[model samples]
Target chain A: MALLSLSAVTLTFAGNTVLNEVSFNVAERSVTSLIGPNGAGKTSLFNSITGFYKPQQGSIRFDGTELLKLKPHQVTKAGIARTFQNVRLFREMTVLENVMSGAHCRTSAGAFAAILRTPAQRREEEEIRARARQHLEFVGVWAEQGRIATTLAYGHQRRVEIARALATEPKLLLLDEPAAGLNPTEKHDLVQLIRRIRDEMGIAVLLIEHDMGLVMQISENISVLDHGEIIAEGTPKQIQSDHTVIEAYLGRDDGEAFLDE
Target chain B: MALTDIVLQQLVNGLVLGSFYALVALGYTMVFGVVKLLNFAHGEVYMVGGFAGFIVLSLVSGTLGSGWSGVAVSMVLAMIGVGFLGVLIQKIAYQPMLSAPRLSILITALAVSLVLQNAVLGLTGGRYVPFGADLGFGGVNLGNLFISYNQFILVGTAGVLMLSLELFISRTQYGRAMRAVSIDKDMCRLMGIDVNRVIAVTFFLGSGLAAAAGTMAGAYYGSLWYFMGFLIGLKAFTAAVIGGIGSIPGAMLGGLILGLLESFGTQIPGIGSAWKDVFSFSILILVLVFKPTGLLGRSEQERM
Candidate 1:
């Protein structure tokens, strides 16, 4: 079943249309990779899905509800969580605090109860803290939970960002360039982690990544986009041999030459 | 001057002054911590608080119970009034500039400050207004020294407020929201905290506290002028920077230290009383150069 769907989505900024009539669906508990060159509207699509920008046309439905109508926070409440391409961890905050912030939406204690430190609020806070630590441990950054997030190495910071998103406990996770700045070892480690998270948490993962090898390795389904539109989408093996995809990637290779290979 | 006596006097005086500075500095630090804006109009907000107190006192004296209850009523009413004024300031002046450059907001804050000060001057005809002293109990003697009950309450109240603020930030959900927004506004948005609402609440709380401080100052000193907030605001800001800019406890600690230094400087031989500002500013510069993070702040490591 389609857990997340974007129908005929169109986005324009300053009279320049970035996305035109884009449509797709993310299956339940499946890994889908969005492969595209720069300015292909991958991030813009993510932004639209997360309610950061209202699409000029079309609908984004997640779990049968209109995702476009929800606010950014409401989008998270609707079971969609995401990490940015650039690591956006709260630098001044400790690792634990950063994750707990993601858990903030789940907390019901308001201003007065929190200020008074009521028993119920205290219990909820403790529960959230325990859960946050578990998420950090899941991402393998639990040991560094007490350190300032900014003090961590680049790989660890990315892990913390993922942990923070996990703290939200969403059904769908959106990862934008999670392996961008990582070294070879870190990228390899991230691939394993992504597989583990999908297998263990049973959450649907939609990712945008530049590392072709990483995408080819982990993604169950792949969609290729160029010039703000999807050009090809299929299973890994099918995508590998598609003449159009080859042309798109290698820049207009003769169709007969690619088919022979 | 006798060393022990001078030191004791300055210490007492410093506590009194520090309490007030802490009250004023809390507003500056709170706003700065969350928004990363200096809020140049905060001084004028302090002045508006004093005016609120004066008007309330006048009204209460004519209608309410004879003495302390009237003063108490006036204080509560003044806090609320000042809180409303803060909201208005945010809605009218600061909110519009949220998307503008930091310099533009700073300029707007300065303009608001000027407007408020001038408005007060126009309303009161530029004269210092005296708030009659009818609430406080007479002074009590300790050993060879005498201390006013008002002074003790002032210090105690400020201390309690500061402690309460610390607890609020560290323990409460609203505080967590504020801290979250301060940390990463976009993430806070993703978490469902309306950044605009959080910022508004910040302005309200900070301004309310400043109002409380202004009221206490008016009642304790028995007189106020339109320009009173300017000097106190400058001193409080200095205190805020001397401590780390976003560190809450640091502001309180800085306020107390600055107050003590200024008081002691007045007692120094050959320095005379006129150089108190000089002495205070000198310490500020030294702290900025030597310990930029102030007394309580721990340095944050950079992330690539």
Candidate 2:
């Protein structure tokens, strides 16, 4: 069964439609990549899925539970986690502290327990620290745990953002332009990490990527969007040859994405 | 008194006042950090804390006797009461203004402050209520220098509160969540944190400190009135800015620094006690001329 399914999702802002009846599903333990041109509404779809934007029409289901009814925080608790296109790590916090914040939904130590330092709270805190360490090591950022998050190099920042997301232990991890600022080696490592996350951890993965190279190499299934609508959905070979997909990006063959800021 | 003894006595006096300023300043800084609101009503919160403690102590003393323990109970109860009031004020006054402009929210805060102050004035008929002359505790003296036991309680309570606040921010899960929210409220929601809840907690803790400070102040200064929080609120906010408005340790340090400045300047030949606030603000002006972002503000590249 699909872990995340969005059917006929429609989102609009100020009378401009961003996602027009967009539909897609991510099967359990699968890799999905969303590819779109600059104005094609890919990020909007991610926003709707993560509860930042509520669609006016259609259903979002996570493991057969209606996800549209949940708030943003509830959506994370409902097994979906995402990273921003630009890294949003707490700049002043240590990398480890940033990642540990991801454990917030799963941990139960509240204000009173934390203030009092109850034994169970202490145990929970210890476990959270250990788990954060595990995710950091998994992402190869264990050594940078003590460094300030913003001080890390660009690629390291990406890894820490991913590590923070992973600490939430989501069933479907959403990556928004994960390879955008990465150098070739960092991109290569990210590719390997995403695969390991799916194969070793058995987590469903969905990402938005402007890098056709990374998308074509890493994704098992691909969805292409143009003008707020899905133009094509298929294997990489099918998407690569689709006339509509090619025409949507005919002028921009460099396949690099730049943000409007 | 000799100059040395006068300076030392003023130093002790400075610490007592500094503890109050630091406690109240923590509230101002924390609220500003998380939501970027000045929360002008915070002064009224200190006033309410004082009045609430006065009422509680008065009611409880008749039953339990006016021992030091009764005063301690009054302080705790007042802290909890004022803490909740802070949360309520946020919900009613500031929460609705989240998307509004800064000026709108600030005006709303001012209105809330007026409401709180007037409500207390109406209830008490605009009179001073004494917290009693003696806390039933003595002081220690060394020749011409002396320090009251309440002064010890004042400084000690402030120390414990600030230290615990530091620990709570650094070591606890909610503390981490609060820091994350301070960075980005939207990102915190993505992390499955209830941003509203974190904000509510901030208001609770911050207001609790203010109230605790007010209760202690009332006990130390010997009375309370509806306008008691007004001047100290400004001073505490100045302390927050002096230390770096959003920095916790900065608020504490700022409070102590402001207090000491006021203390020492009062003894100066020209400034004297009458020019205490003028001297304190002059120091703030001098410091800002050199360090623009306030003491521990985020813009400082070099922490030293």
Candidate 3:
């Protein structure tokens, strides 16, 4: 069954339609990829699902809740978390603190409880710290958890961002170009991590990636977006052979030349 | 008095005044940290806090009796009231303009300040309202130095408040969320933190601290006026900038440094008391000219 379903989501900004009648479903515990050429509204679809941009029409339902009715934070609270295309760790915070901030949605301590350090607040804090450590360990950055987040290497920072999102304990994790800046070895590890997140953590994954090799290897289902609409949706074998997707990536004339190979 | 004795006395006075500045400066720094808004009306929140405490003291002194206990009750109540007022101001005035241009929000802040000032002026008829709380005029004599009981209370209370605020920011979950929001608001929302609530709490705590300072200042100085927040507010902003505007520890340090500078600057034979503000402002200009990030502030690259 689909954990997330979008029906005819249409988003327009200042009379310019950024996303038009886009529809797709992310199955529970499945790895899905949204692939497109640049400015094909892939990120716009993610924004719509994450509630950053309210679509003028259409409904996004996640885990039986209408996401369009919720605020961005509320969407997160309803078990959706995402990472940015660029690493966005809290610069001033220690690595562990950045991950701990992800526990904010799941934890319930208010300002007064925190200021007073009530017994329950203390216990909850300890739990948050433990969970953050676990997520950091899961992403293999546990050793560097004490250092400032921004001081880390680019790859480690990406790992930290992943851990931070995982700390939110989302049912579905959205990763925007997770493999964008990684070395070949780092990309290999990310594939392993994505599998672990699905197989072990049981969190569904939806990602946007330009790396066709990584997407083909990891994605169970792929959706291709072009010019504010979905051009195709299928398994890796099906999408790789889709004539329209080839035209979308390569121009009509170039697509014919590429198909011969 | 001997030169050494005069210096010692000024040191004590500087500490007392520094506590107030530090308290008020925290509001400016914290609000700026979270929203990057100057919140110019914060001074008026402090002014309103003073009036709130005054009203609380007047109403309760008949029952609680005007003593240390009465002042305590009044300060607590005033802080709570003014904290809510700060939140309300953020919601009604600043929050909507958050997405507007930076200049527009700043103008709104100025408008809010003017409105608060005029509102208070109309209520009090621009007259000095006597605080009327007798916090005792006694003092401890240490050689040629005289330190009042009120000074001790003011510094001790401010110290405790500042320490607690530091702890709250460093150790609490909400505090961590606040730090994260300051760094990246949109990303923080992905972490499921209600960014609006964090900003509101920042205002609440900042305004509450200012209110505590306001109540203590009224009780110690024995006078309150509609325009009281104007000069002090600017001085506190100076202190925030000096401490590195968004750094919590910086605000406390800046307040103390500014207070000491003003205190000792007045002792110069030619400068005198009237030139106190001149010295404080001159230091602000110097800090801006040299270390624009303030003493504790990191550069933009490090901060963002």
Task: Give me candidate 3's TM-score against the actual structure.
Answer: 0.97
lDDT of 2 by residue, B190-217 (tens): 9999999899999999999999988888
RMSD of 2: 3.0
In TM-score terms, candidate 1 sits at 0.89
Please state the interface RMSD for every predicted structure, separated by commas.
1.7, 0.6, 0.6
lDDT, candidate 3, at B134: 83
User: How close to the true structure is residue A254 of candidate 3, measured as C-alpha lDDT?
Assistant: 43
CA lDDT, candidate 3, residue A238: 96
User: How many clashing pairs per prediction, in order?
Assistant: 0, 0, 0
Complex DockQ, candidate 1? 0.52
Top candidate on lDDT is: 3
- Tell me the TM-score of each prediction against the true structure: 0.89, 0.96, 0.97
**How does model 3 score on DockQ?**
0.87
Evaluated on CA atoms against the true complex, candidate 2 attains a DockQ of: 0.86
In order, the Cα lDDT scores of the candidates are 0.83, 0.88, 0.93
Candidate 1 CAPRI category: medium
